[model samples]
Target: MSKTPAFNRRAFLGSAAALGATSVVMPSYAQQIDPYTGQPIVGATAGATPDAGAVQYDTHANQRHNISSFRAQDWRPYFDNLSNGAILCDLTSRAVHYWSEDETVYRLYPSSIPVSEDLTRTGRTEIIKKVEGPSWAPTPDMKKRNPEWPDFVGPGPDNPLGTHALWLSWQYYRIHGTHDTRKIGRKSSNGCIGLYNEHIKELFELSTVGTQVLLI
Candidate 1:
């Protein structure tokens, strides 16, 4: 940095002009906030609110930030696959986001749609295959604990597996139909992924026996 006279009026005017020009072309996708206070932020001169459709707090704790104030660009990251295209899971928010083969975004599902109450912190692999009249075999532990549940589970609208089950390849973790629709937007599951009954049914209708499923 070089020192200049504090009262350099010409220099100040030139710098202000450049800043004004830059702000005019700033993209909506960029997120900015006050460096000191965690409030909606823009440049020093004028405060700007975050763009709802663009910039979003990357994590529930706001540990990371993003910029998405302009255009129809997506701000979420995802995993790509040949059969499943790309998918994004916001674990903090419990939301599943899906995109097309071309990476054109499509749908967003609130987390409450499926919950895993018994979910442990350990991460593991799982398999998934669409099944009709899916039977939910309660673990011996679950049966011993939950005496209310029948010994042999059967498929129905109220079944825990609901109408469809995308059984996980990782043994027990499944993205399955939910009997409780009210819990869709919450972090309440028995360690298996859950989807709204209607949604799971739709996914079931769309998927074949060998349809590939991945958790991101």
Candidate 2:
């Protein structure tokens, strides 16, 4: 007999394609940037909106979110920093944008939590590996153990890897999904990049197991 196709999280979050959002009333500290030069975009007054048309962002409000902090004069270090690799997000805008060299950049799916202080590491290296739906397996090194930890949910809605998972070049480092939808576009994860369920599904499907994940 035939078995069921693995459960896909993207299928469950179908609403993501039709999703909408409202803009956060950001603090004044978050705006200001050089347009021509990609530098430490200075902070701007709370009421001003700059770079109205150049910055590419995806927002829930369905209204334009100006990237007032970046100056057009600034220059991105250039993707040449690492060839055949993708920038997880565009720090030039200091916002979450993911795209390849030839593509237009857009806001990354929002993130759930801020960077946990626990994720302290001095340095990171680059490598390539295969990615698959994370099979929530408990490792011997886990500080704490969950006896009831789910194993191999077999690629369904409940899978934390969600719509997609990018197996990093290094071992155990992945860019995958989060059950936490509210938190995106911020620093959060256990040394891995997390994307919204829908967005990840798109990435996962577009990518393959050996796709290179660069974290320089």
lDDT of 2 at 69: 30
Q: Candidate 2: how many backbone clashes?
A: 32
lDDT for model 2, please. 0.38
Q: TM-score for all predictions?
A: 0.53, 0.49
Candidate closest to the true structure, highest lDDT:
1
Model 1 stretches astray by more than 4 angstroms: 1-76, 80-82, 102-105, 113-118, 121-127, 207-216
Q: Write the per-residue lDDT of candidate 2 for residues 1-216, one digit (tens) a residue.
A: 999655333442453223322234332232232222334333221111111011112232123223353222211453333233343333222233344334443224433221333542223333244345554443332213223333334554445455556655555555667543423444433445566666666665544443333332
- Segments in model 2 whose C-alpha atoms lie over 4 Å from true places: 1-75, 89-96, 103-107, 112-115, 120-134, 143-148, 183-188, 205-216
lDDT for each of the candidates? 0.43, 0.38
Report residue 136 deviation for candidate 2 (angstroms): 2.5
